[model samples]
Target: MQATDNVTLDNCADEPIHIPGSIQPHGALLAFDIDGALQAWSDNAPQLLDLTLALGAPLASLPLPAEVHAIAAECRDLIEDGEAPAIALEVAIGTHQFDCIVHAYAARIIIEFELREVPSDAVAAFALKAHAAIDRFKRQKSIDSLLQLATEQVRAITGFDRVMAYRFHQDDSGDVTAESLRDELEPYLGRRYPASDIPAQARRLYIINTLRLIADINYRPSPLVGRAGAAPLDLSHSVLRSVSPVHIEYLQNMGVGASMSVSIVVNGRLWGLLACHHMTALQVPYSIRMAADVMAQVIASIVQSIEARERALMAEQSAAVRTRVMETLLHHDEPARALLQHAPALCLSLQAEALVVAQYGKLMVHGDIDLALAERMVASLPQSGDEIIERSALGDWPEELRDALAPWAGMLALRFDPSTSGWLLALRREQINTIRWAGRPDKIVRVGPLGPRLTPRGSFDEWRETVRGRAVPWDATARLAAGQLLGEMHRASVARHVETDRARSQLLAMLGHDLRGPLHSINMAATVLQHGGAAGTMSTRIQASSGRMERLISQVLDMSRLNGGLSLGLEKNLVDLVPALQDLLDESRIASPGLRIVADLPPALPLMMDSDRMMQVVSNLVSNARHHGAQGEAIEVTLAERGDTVVLEVRNVAPPIGAEMVANLYSPLKHTSVGNVHNRGGLGLGLYIAQQIVHQHGGEIAYRYEEPQVVFAVSLPRN
Candidate 1:
């Protein structure tokens, strides 16, 4: 019989165990290895055992070694009956006893004693220590420092040989940035491994199985299939464990004897791995491995903080640099060429040896380089609007740039604009190796009698290779700043262009207004002379010329006002469409007596529109059709209401507008020189101006080509 005071059980492996009623029961199981420390069992173990005993059957005490198996079997039956009890098992090493208790639910295990009972304060202190560790991790701010500190903490807790913070690159390669190694072991810090070494399939497996353990990479298989009562673990949860067999094989191939890795997740994505490796064959019990995983949680938070700080700093610096460049460029009042000439010295602070300016698809300014070489560099650049850089051999000159200085050794080219053949800036770095080889014996003969002629240490070929086949020296942040500066420069250029255009338009408007008064006076005087005098040939000719001059003045004034952004005042009224059409027809008949004119106006069609602008729109279309149509052909004006708009159309019977003319008729300065087959007389601004006026009144003008005739139509909003 076991001594009641000593509470010792030895070789009692097969004996029935009794729990003291004085100890409060909680559903938790604890296991301790004789060679190591204690391990906590799942909280559900006690409840499972209680349910097993409540099924109207006497409980049998299993031997110590077979306790786990017996409890699993009983729990399975209790789970089926829906009344599993929580159980706590404490394996005592010194006493050679296994203490067991059953509870209906999970609660603290308090072993109450009268005089010298189990130390309750010591157990509570252990719990507090674990909670404090987690709290310290939660309060960390810097990710780099957090990772470094966490690795040290985990190493101290678990006694692992080397702990590392491994990060995955964009290409799936992995890098070890931080590591904590024992004093005896050499460091494997700042090492990068290729993605191919891991393979794509293995990475996918790692993400699925969050935590993995290769207890002994060289350990022979136990050949025990399906350890009993092993619940299926969902590794996707924050606290779950699953190991992949393939990873074990990989570690073995890498000559690693033992390995453990935990996934570091950020924003729901697998960020990297927290890996520990041991060269000598070793095994970390499940409890210590869990502690390492908990520490990894703290490391993840620290990394995120560091990355956020770095990104914020880079953005702030880029903004500051861009602001400085814009202020410097806009400080001067000069042409783009003068500004760029001083820009390299001012903006780059003379860091660059040379500067070049390209404008209107030509090299306008260059410094410290021959014009031919400058042109060649510009030609090699891409024609796209965005800035670009290129590298090429200096000796092989294309036909377009044959005369440049003896081949360029190295060069950097930037294109400002491709549309107007704008400027290209080129900076040349001459080849020095070629100069040193000119007189050396190594250049002339292969065999040298004088212990080999002097040879140059650094060659142009070496320098060229260093700079070639690589992106521009600027980083992403610097390039972004440069792009912002270019945008400001382009805006200044565009502003200058707008101001110039406005000034020219204003001048033309004033000239047209001044000419209109004199031309109107001439027309009035001519009309009086033609009626008061004998209506002679000279009198008639003067009147016709005066009328033409008046028309020209009116066109110029109207174009000026339109370009000046004069608004059209629209007075809405219900006006019958027939009378307007009849009035236009009478004017057209008087203007050309020999031409046949027809009016098909609907009496009930009424429109709400600016009447004056509408009349001008109709007159422009009718006159254009008549002028372009054949002699003696009938010109038809039609009006009707369709849907929500009133439609007015003027059709002429004449030769069809040629395909080329039809496509470009409304474009300004589109002069067609097709001999007698094409007639090009006006500035091509009439239809454009007419379209604008019609659009201003909420109407649209369109043209259709019908065989032997062309129709111009205007649609206005209806009342």
Candidate 2:
């Protein structure tokens, strides 16, 4: 007899569920040595098996079949073959038919005998039914529907009052995902059970057993007694191993008299359970249990195949956005702006509310987020690892980051490199979460005579609570996609550096050839002037050559500084623009004698600007007009002030640029040779440098072709 007074809430966790010290009365258990002599037997075995000998008696003394020993040896070999040492087979002994199970554990061989027999016709029926169930599983299109079909099939085969397909969560707790039940039974679908209901040791046993059955919850437990000095039987592999008393009480509380469970394994790990319960004592034949077990194995194999296929589809979709971003970076020089062009894919596919992508100390924020919070979060992450750090709740963040991370609670961050400070952080907001538990799990203990005892809760009441400062968990699929993104981004970053190196080499090659001409001309002209040969003509020639050399030197210096990411310092002041325009026009007329130049500005149009930088910007555009604009067309510069803003439009009638070629037109060192000598093979930095200056002054420069002209407009704030 067991004493209920000894069980306490604090000690319940230590309960030896693996070794219950007995077996259920519906089945007979026996433990024997290598010599095939019975060394231990359940108290009911004598009557159940009708044995005629004492303990340690050879099995040949009783009416045992020859096939039992041969099959028992084969069952024992399962242990060495990395399989469970358990096999179910039917046997007949002296007019009594029984379903027998043989299992080997350590030094002992344990066998269980149940009063069961399948008719010849029933054997054919069981095989057909199992095949039909597998066919239904194949027809299911989704995991949800497949599991539902599994539960329904098991219920139909076993005649249980209720059957549920329960799936385990990352926390080890389980939820009833799908279910089938008799009309009289209450539904258990969508209910969640705490992990404590099944202890760690119990779960390990599940991996070994795969399936469990309790024929009569009300049956008395039968103790296994060995010879006087023989050790107690280890029933870990026994089919008739008695269950925990607490679990019995729990089932009894739920008005369940019997239960069965089949393990659903995927990729060699236990994923969930096919749980069946009956409102009354239910005796299931061994053949029926075998059918259910086969169905569970089928579900495991199919589930793995389906999940892999789904992951492949998601990877392809995510690749589309990543590929586009990579292509842009390859052709352009800006990674931040390039990534922003595909912000929708980055956020929507990852199920994130916002994303902050940082590379090489530059950060680009996308979607909904407090910029300050995002910056702090990315800055706080370690810069020495490529690990994906996840914070499901912001409250758990460091004190310095918590306030900044307000409103948004979850983050999934991926660093491109550990030794460098670059990252991709995905943010999620807190959700008003709702969960359905089987009962108030916190209130599961009751006051006992000794102390508090752990027991099942009396009532399963609807419990609702508000959840805050937590975001939806980062699921497996999302993390997998992040990993793929990390690899693709790494490859793209490497490719970008290679492209930059190639472009720089090409620029050096062009500069070498372009500088040779001016230097040779200067040398020849200097010799003539120094030798007193026609001083006026030679001096003019030397002066023009020197000026051309100076311009080339200045352009090279500016391009180098811009490519190296140096700042363009600007000093702003309110100035009249008409005079500045007149001076630049004078220079453009002298520099290009072929093109026409004109300026249209309000007489008193004044605005705050960096005069030197604005002059540099206009000079580049004018130089480009002389070199690239049509020969006979006028380059028009118009200045118009509206309220507090100003627009500077530079337009020239010329051939329209093709749509495909416009993006590359902004790239530095990209140009076409002019027909004549003055501007042949000019480094394509005039428009590029002009764009940089306009952007620095909090203004935009855009280009468009309209009919017979190309327009470049600069919109600047006139404060």
Candidate 3:
């Protein structure tokens, strides 16, 4: 005997249930080798078949009818070709009829015979009902509807006391989703069963053997008598395989005398079961059982179709959101800011309670979250890779993080790209799940006919279990959508880097070209002073060249600091903005002799600001106007106070900026030649740096084209 034949509570999972070495007493089993010599026979075969058996006698020597030999020949060919499970036929022996099932395995032919009194009309009647049931199934609009109708039809066709449509969850637990029962029976709908009820090995058998029946739980088992040193038969696909003792005990405890289950296999996986139970021993004929099996297969197909359609719809919605986010990234220079603008929509699409984006060393969050706490969560993730981390509950988190993740239990984090130091997180709030199980799942050890073993629990009363600190489990579709979104985001990030590199190359080219003139002028002036010719003029020329170089280098440095996420280091003091503007305009006229600079200023509009930096802001705006404005156009500068707000406006007359240039106005190292009269030669960092500086002073800056003039405006609070 195998070690699992005498199983204990701890080793129940190791039981080799497929090779039980026996068959249920309702049928008789016979095995013959290729030479037609009887090799194995069940003990009850003599009484059930009314025949005498010999250990090594050929099947042609037996008293069985000649028809049996002819049918067996056809079955051997079909089995060898993998065409069907087995060939079933009704045969007569003297005055009795039996359902004969024949198949071949290991070069041996196995046959099972079960006595039946089926009438001629039964087959035609079941076929008609089966066709009608399938026609109605095609009308079902949803899976639940189809399943409920299926349970009703199976119960009607088999005359069972109760039938239930059960579905398995990702955790291996099952729920009775639909049921059809007699009016007097108690309802089992909406009840749940724990994963322990169906062990892993049992589930594997279910997938292989689609239909199983136990005529009577109390019936005795008939042991197979084999030749000496015969190997135990593998009865995984046997029609009359005996049920496990523990499983029989389990049904007995549920007050069921006979039971049947048809597996619902979807895409090669066991999705659920069609369970039927009888209050008393009731033997269903093989024909009716086959009909029930066909119904189950139909149900599995319909379920797969409906679920696929729903998942496709969800994917379409997710794709729409992805498109919008990608467009925002392409249009805006700052990815973090652009993503934050669509946080609400993204959270909704992902079915998440909150969202966090960490990119470019900046943290952006939505839905009432602390920045420091979010940073901590980001730090806990691996520094690189596109690995995804998913957690369904706070209890699943590390002990140190459990308390911190309270109220927010589920987390789906994606570290999409190794090239970028960033993470995207979608969070769900804690949801308390209340489950009502059919019984307490824990088994009790008891001494029974088989020695000490774990027995099924005697009580099957309704048991309620409260599960805490968990959100609704994320389904496979949601996880797939998350992966798709991250992939798109990674691609967009790579594109941004490529564009930035191109801009840097352009800046290097422009700087090299512009700096050459200043250096050449300085060298020429130095040589003139060395010759002691025009000493004052050479000194003046050198000072002008040095000033130009200083301005260009300063602009580059400011842009670099802003790009690195560093502060401008403002030193604030209560200052008069009116004087700052006047000084800027006065310096503008001196630098550009032909350009007319006009100002509109209040006598004294005082505010808190860094005087030098604030002046630099105005100076850059004026310089940009001078370079890009129309020839001989007056540059207008205005400063005023409007109810606790100080306003600054610089206006220049020029043609409207091109749409492409306007879109990338604040991007660094841009070069554009609008017209011959307008001079645009610089690193293109003036507006970008000016915007950053104004943002540091708790102010707003914006640009607009008003008819014949292009206007740049800055607004700061007067405090």
Candidate 4:
């Protein structure tokens, strides 16, 4: 199957190139149906195969050699078994031997013949050369060194004028990454070729064929002779198949007579090529070609091994960075602020030109980044996706934002938190390159023997072009590093929150326990003063202050227990809630005489609940309203039954809570303020404790601001 997307041969001459209905003059092709009847034969087949045959001629009827007949029979059986076999062997006809390649494709059997002129020791020589190359490959440490070694080995093995290890870029362009050429020849090393040089269709063919050889660019293409009305022969698998005329012209323009390309496929994708060019027509025997194929496979495996090791090393380094950053974040109360100090290190580790961290409505940038641009980039990020969004080319970005990105050509943004609008963005600067093309990359339309069509450029001299607006494309390693850092950041944030909460809970528990003794002694002294008939205003004030202190300590201890994941120790009973509300309101009114409070209660409503805990809930809510409500406004408490549930609403006239504060409204120890409504007094735990108490009773507590009134509604099931 052909590869798709950007490399598709659709609407192009690639499809026609696959079945060109011809073969090169240096070889001959004969195609047969599954039943061994001659379907097609190249015009040169008679001269190369030493046969006098016509279309529809049976293999047994033809005057071909017996070896050809035996190979055809073997191929037929394999084809019948649904196995496409590419078998190569030596065959002799009229005292002349030729290399015969046979393969089956789509129920058709193709036999290709090439003249073999190698010495008797050719195989032995190739084996020694290949073994030495393999040894050198094993000793190479880096990919560049391996590629250079491969080029040298291939050039020595093939005897080509120039051997280049060409690498394909993200944009399909190619660079001569490593080269081995004759000393007197001009070096094409380090030269770049536009993607158009090898059209998408040709690249596809390279992947399927793996080895392509053009023995002579000047060789005439002998058309296949077949029935006039029959479909053209499919020579996609023909070893002696004729190549595209445009490519032949392309090589001729560069003054190249012979060329061969061995594809370097990594992980099943065409990665690059070991391209060999000779100044004169040259034919490499099948043995040498097979040896080259083995070398290419070895090179591909080594490339994969090297890349995998590099990725593993990157993962190890990224993990170390994550640990250091996470520890720093956990140590500081303000994680975002702490992260800013390590942004430079993070940017370096990510191989980024700059790094921007957006957290809790703030932007912190490291390296050469404009603050305003960073802010705009943060705003451009999607608010909700957890997946990393990356683009290596600035052209892939929105046109409006492209200019603003300026020197930066790539952006990688990831939003780690779904609840907050923040992102971790890594930027890469433009790699502005000066490309030296082997020829002018532009293809022109001109009249040729094939007719008016796209023709190859006539120039082969170095054509220099400046390329910009691209970066040293981000790879999987960068993505992995970014993801790892964000994951650790998330984990560390949770850990820090837990640690802070734990420490606060511990302090409150200790303070509450220590104050109990002093509070109890004060209460006892007040009681003695009252009993001695000397209880004056001073004694009354002392008793009231001590009582308030005792209530505050009790709330602190309760909040501490709740924060520590301990459940409330409640005593249950089937009791009426009206009396409890009334008693709580009476006490609240007595305690805060200046503050007006009112209640709307049903006379008798009984439920299965902890009556003391129920009183605590009501008292906490009432206390919250009294503390946070608008001055001179009355606190309204309503207890009503609604079908299967009872709703207790503590409504007070207060300013609306800010949206930001509302998220943490029921959180313990949060000091929330909106406009004039300040959250002051009493440890900020009343609403939180009330919420937990309601939850333990299989009920829910909710808060909403309705115009001038803030409502805290507690709903419980009426069993």
Candidate 5:
């Protein structure tokens, strides 16, 4: 339908396009009663069949051939079951041969007769023709080309004088988008038609049936013989249903004697109509109509595919544009300057004539447009939120803004953030278009002999009208890409906030966590000295606590270096890993009398590593094992030479650790709490610092849960 929010259809919505009660002249129709008695017949039927009007005569006694009787019987069976059936059979009555279609409708049995032709190989020829037509549809590269090809192929198969692909707008009005016809006929392509031509009921029927044909519009109608208590027939599904008198007049007014229509459905909705028109009587077999329906289906499928491909292509291109714009926004400190510098390429990518950037309350205008008007427009639009994707004509805007917005006809605005209201607005200058209607589209009613009657235009002359105040339409793909861009920007904005918040939080936690142990150690030593403990013991306590604080400061420095992606500045030396680990083990044992420790190592196995850092890595592993390991199980440290590498393995027994907790231990400045929060003293950066030191020495450190043992393995390059 038309993209405008205000849709007006005049009398089109009320017109009854269906319920027409007349058949075309090319086919004669007869209505029969439940007893197979001829009750009512079209005026042309009497002359064509050489029979006089005998209202109550049973059709079986009309002296027709046996085939006609059998056709009548099949029709009766269908009628009894409330089914409308089309049966094709040859009839010979008084030396006259004809092809008859016996159809069963509610309240009456209608028989339609046509002059049949005998083709040498109709089935084989039709199959080949259908294949060729479908191949043509597959080869089309665009929706326009495919629609044009479809009409041409349908015309070739059905032998209609003219065929057109008519597309319906959102308001139910339509235009002939593509047409193929005899060279002698006038073209109807691009001619607009009002929705009254095919009302809601007709559109619904087309969706269900897919095909309908009026062999000849000039024919008289056969009235259904009414039973005493029967209601009118609901002929909505009848193949040979009579056309409404209004539709009959409409066709005759258009000078179309014969017509047919096939529905093009896409995504389960009626997308458009493939209409066929003829100047004279025409008849096509049901099989031919079936083939045409298939072609219409193929066209629908291709339309959906082309639309999807276009969307995918738009998204790919939009992503590149968004990425470039994002980079500019991130690097440039000024929003207005960045927008102005990128406006040309950005407008081109969005197909906009002007661009506007509204950040906070400040507005910036760019591209070809009135600067004052754009600033006002951006200022008027909402500064925050991405909820509504507003698109409207300039005329419909507020009176205050409309006068200033004269330079453009439409505006599209999107807010990237709710708090800051970072909005991006695009504007398009008014696009004036000339539309051609089949006739005076406004004058759809004609004052006729009896009354004011609704009819198709009597003339096909071009009636042109200039359309203004509307911009070039933004397609679905463009809208989708715009939405995606806003989403990306919103995510980026939130991430920046989180990053800033995390930096502040990390600094406070670091000070508290790193100083807790040192202050506690000093207080304990002073308390011992005041209590008259031996001077040597108190001195040793003070020295040990002081040494521990110095080591912690060193670790904090190492962590800072790693955060900046700097090396540990290793002091490498040939050192025995076994002895270094042994020294730490002995100290831990003395510190914790209840600690269980074990060592399995080859004596004097030396390796080149940062001697001080290697000792720290071993010490951290041993400390972590003692704190979390099973209370009575041995904390084992194994060192060996494996090929060209020195491997140090520490094993402890503990409960399974959660993945999130393990991640927290390795991540920077991340802790549930400081000091005793982990049920152990000191900061939570030991393993992280150890891993960095190992990396600086060109060695590897890894952790794994080994059933009863939680294993930490360190492999150093033995050079």
Candidate 6:
């Protein structure tokens, strides 16, 4: 009896064999019918046994035919006596050899059998083997061991020339990462195939289906009922069905007569394919192929785990390297050069060849390049503060230099400095064999005479060439390491900036303390002379000189406070504006007896303001008018109120304020007319400070020029 004939059996004593839909319930038993007549029934029986063992099912307790009744009884007694199930089993009244699997709860058994003529001993051996394999698979732990053991088991059961673990890329490309083959077979490690070979549509179809078995490349395809246009290439449903003729032809072109592929899914996504290939025409029973598929699934999980672990480890190492780099550079006395020297070592440790730090048109530092070529190379590159890669011919480099570099080789450039040193270039050379072409030869070259082109062959060469020199550009691992190093450098820079800011603040504090005392004394002495008038002529001279010195000191203090971001205090009070103006006039008249003074004050004008600061503001304005106004010309002071504020105006009959001077009238250092006045000689801090003080009280100060007369006014808030 052949496995293929078992599909038509209709013996149902309790319940018809439940053929499940696409979604199988948990713990549901799956049934499959094997195909193909065997040369020796005994030889083929062991294959069925292998399938049972792999699926974790005991075979002895299954129903048997009359011819095998004696053996079935013996096996049944063994099971009733608490013995584990065996491989050889009976199904459908002695016509079929079947493997039976009990549910986890041992409540029922799902029997899988074939209608092929098989040796009685061979069937019994298969039962035992199937039980043992299932037990081991169930006990397996860890993804790697499960995959390795599963692959080996499948290969042994299927007798394929080569069994390979095929992982898929993000772009749908596939690569053979692991392989199991006979001793005489060649290794296909790290071989990559383009996504085009399978086509996008085929890959999409594969994702939904799990197993595909091509018994013979020369066999004609049998289309499924209602399947139109092309015959269905998938055979998970039609056991023993022929493959599509087109696919068979396609395989024949590739020199393969038979092939079986099983999808390895991870987290419900098709992660890769487990492929079995045979050089000669071959037929695999559905039972054996299905078992292989299960084994492939286990291997897929292990591959995924290995990939995840590798990525996680790399990320952790990168972070640690970055931290160390930053600490070493930022703490160094000379950070710039220290960072440069450390860059190469970091790159080397990370397995990279060169480190480049570029800012705008400047190359701050470069490592691992010939000294003779470095200067020329740096100069030829464009000055840009952008992060980008520089492939052999893709960047602003001399043609000669570009020619010297390899194809499919380039550097990974990142922005380290946001403003100036915006690019950090880390060079890397991919392995030749790993290079791929996507029809854009200009974009990615595999091989050329200029150096190494990035054509398919050249790309593959770079991928396979693992030796240091064989890698034209550098090493990818090194580039990543350099990237980690740059992160560290940035951290160091930030720390140094913080420290420098602290030191600058401290220096400003010390300077402010040392200058405050002398400034206060000069201001006091000037005030005393204006009030006491001890040595008539000498006192007047001392008072005027001290007043000038005091102005200089006040300017310094105000400038310092402004730069230090200190806020001014405004103490407002209701005061008679007339008295304040009169006092300022009196002081001014005494200081400059040679100048005429005129006062126009309304008797009862009250202003809400900081009186002391207001008095200082008035004094400064009046003194400035006296000094800079036409010598001996009368200086007019007027007090008035409009709206919610009082205005005090000092009109001087001096040279009209120049356009340039008016623009910078309150600037401390650039007070042109005021600084030029001999009696008002200082850093021109008076007007600037007066403006600041007036603003602090929520008032404004303005200067107006009317050809022959220049008027300076201050408006303060009202009571």
Question: What TM-score would every model get versus the actual structure?
Answer: 0.39, 0.83, 0.86, 0.68, 0.58, 0.44
Cα lDDT over the full model 3: 0.81
Summarize candidate 2's per-residue lDDT along 1-719 as a digit string, tens digits.
33455544446667777667799888788777765688888888878877654688775565667787777777656655333457777887666678898877767777788776557467568667888999989877788988999998999888899999989877778889999998877787988877776767777777777888898889899987765687666676676889887778878877888999899988766788999999898877877887898899999888887888887777787788678866876676556566667778888667788888776555678877767667788778875654788888866678777776667888888775443355778888888667787776553556656565677655555555456777888988889878787777777667866766887887777777676777787788878777878878877777777776676677777777765555466788988877898888888788667668878888877777888888887887777666668888899999898777788888887788787658776777664522236355356666677777787787878888887878888888877
Q: By how many angstroms RMSD does model 6 differ from the true structure?
A: 22.8
From the highest TM-score down, the ranking of the candidates is: 3, 2, 4, 5, 6, 1
Pitting candidate 3 against candidate 4, the one with the higher lDDT is 3
CA displacement after TM-score superposition, residue 288 of candidate 2 (Å): 1.4
Candidate 4 or 6, higher lDDT? 4
> Cα RMSDs of all predictions?
25.2, 4.8, 4.3, 17.5, 15.8, 22.8
What is the C-alpha lDDT profile of model 4 across 197-236, one tens digit per residue? 7877777788878888888888888988974566777767
* Cα-based lDDT at residue 443, candidate 2: 32
Better of 2 and 5 by lDDT: 2
Find the candidate with the highest TM-score and give its number: 3
Give the winner by TM-score: 2 or 3. 3
lDDT of 6 by residue, 1-719 (tens): 22222211111111111111111111112221111111111122333343222222223333334534354344444453233243333344233334332211121111223343445465455445544555566565554455455556666677788787776766566776667887786566567665544544345445655776665666433221211232222322323334332345446645676788888877666677777888886555445655665555545555566656765676677766676667655544334334565675556555556665544343444544654444444445455644344453234344666655543145555655554344555555535443433222222322234343222211222133222223344344445655565566666667765765664565455344434444565556667676874546645555655665566666676766743435456687887778877877887777656767888889888777777888888888877886677866788888887888788899988778778667657755442423253433555567778887886776889998877899988887775
Worst 10 residues of 3 by lDDT: 673-682
Encode model 5's per-residue lDDT on 198-260: one tens digit a residue: 767778888877888888787666544433344444456555667766666778878898999
Off by over 4 Å in 5: 1-12, 15-17, 21-127, 170-173, 227-231, 319-351, 382-386, 444-455, 500-719
Q: Write the per-residue lDDT of candidate 1 for residues 250-295, one digit (tens) a residue.
A: 5654456777777777655567787787777554443345456555
- List the lowest-lDDT window of 10 residues for candidate 2: 672-681
Candidate 3 scores a C-alpha RMSD against the true structure in Å of 4.3
* Per-model CA lDDT versus the true structure: 0.51, 0.76, 0.81, 0.79, 0.73, 0.54
